[model samples]
Target: METQLRKGAHAVFNIQFHIIFVTKYRKSVINEAILSKLREVFSRVCEKRKCELVEFNGEDDHVHLLVDAHPDNNISQLISFLKSASSRIIRKEFEIYLKQFYWKKEDPSFWTDAYCIVSTGGAPLEVVKEYIKAQQKPKM
Candidate 1:
């Protein structure tokens, strides 16, 4: 993992976050098309927020984001933005899929309210990279 530290007005920092968000009820609705769109959506969101999206990957029900943001950026706010923006776009674009799995009177929730966010600065980037990569495998 090549992590270049970012410099701001007064502070030079390298802050990265490992963020995970699951579909509502942990439904396995995500496919390759959705994953591709998600990567694009997340990249756009991060760019708008002036953050770097280091890496992104997902399974059927959830997605993982590795973001390198400035220290001044509010992590929770970023998470909210990611979830909201992606949810709206995804639900609209993939209405057919949503209808089958997320049928409801109102707009079905695209993502669960709860999320997992962790700071990656506590460990080496390589270690974190391996950990994230391992998420794809089944436990023995």
Candidate 2:
């Protein structure tokens, strides 16, 4: 993926993250329809946060996202928003499909509390270290 730097008033940054969100109880309820809804919701959430949803895909039980975010964005809060909004919308839109997994009596949670997020993009750590080491030092 190409790394594009974004300019803010005081900072220029290129930050990207690979995040994964799993379904509560690892239920295999997600299908093409739900995935489509998820992509729509996630894209909107990212846009609202001044970020971009670079890539999005998922299996029956989990979803993967490659997000390009601004430096000032709080990733934790963004994830929370994504989960909450998507859960509420999905529960309402596909209540029939999800009923088997989440009974009427249950609270009807979509995603698990735990998630995996890793910083991505830019050069490898060792490559960056080598480049820094190769820089010429100025004479004092």
Candidate 3:
């Protein structure tokens, strides 16, 4: 994949993260339908935050995402938004299916409190450097 960079008035950055989110209590609540919805929700969240959802996939209880974002973006905040929005929507839309996993709780949380986030790179240093060099430098 080509490296995607974001430019600001004084900076340019290509920040990518591999994010993993597990369901509350690691219950196998996710199905093909949930996975599809999760992908859609994640893509929309990333777009709203000016990030790119490069890749998304998941298993029964957890999901993985590759996101490309700008330096100005706060990673944690982005994650919070994603989780909150997705959880709300999923719980609401799939209430019947999710009832089994959440019947005991008054308020059900779809995801666990902790998440995994790792930095990733799409291109090597030399290639990135060459691409940067090829860009028209800002007029001083």
Q: TM-scores, in order shown? A: 0.82, 0.91, 0.82
Q: Tens-digit lDDT track for model 3 on 1-140?
A: 67657787788887889999999999999999999999999999998998889999999999999998877678889999999999999999999999988875676679999999998887777898999899997899
Put down candidate 2 lDDT per residue, 82-128, tens digits, no spaces.
89999999999999888889885567688898999999878999998
Task: Tell me model 1's lDDT, rounded to 2 decimals.
Answer: 0.90
Model 2 accuracy (lDDT, Cα): 0.92
Task: Please state the error at residue 99 of candidate 3 in Å.
Answer: 0.5
| Worst lDDT 10-window in candidate 3 | 1-10
- RMSD per model, one decimal: 10.6, 1.7, 5.1
Instruction: Estimate the TM-score for candidate 2.
Output: 0.91
How much is 20 displaced in model 2, in angstroms?
0.4
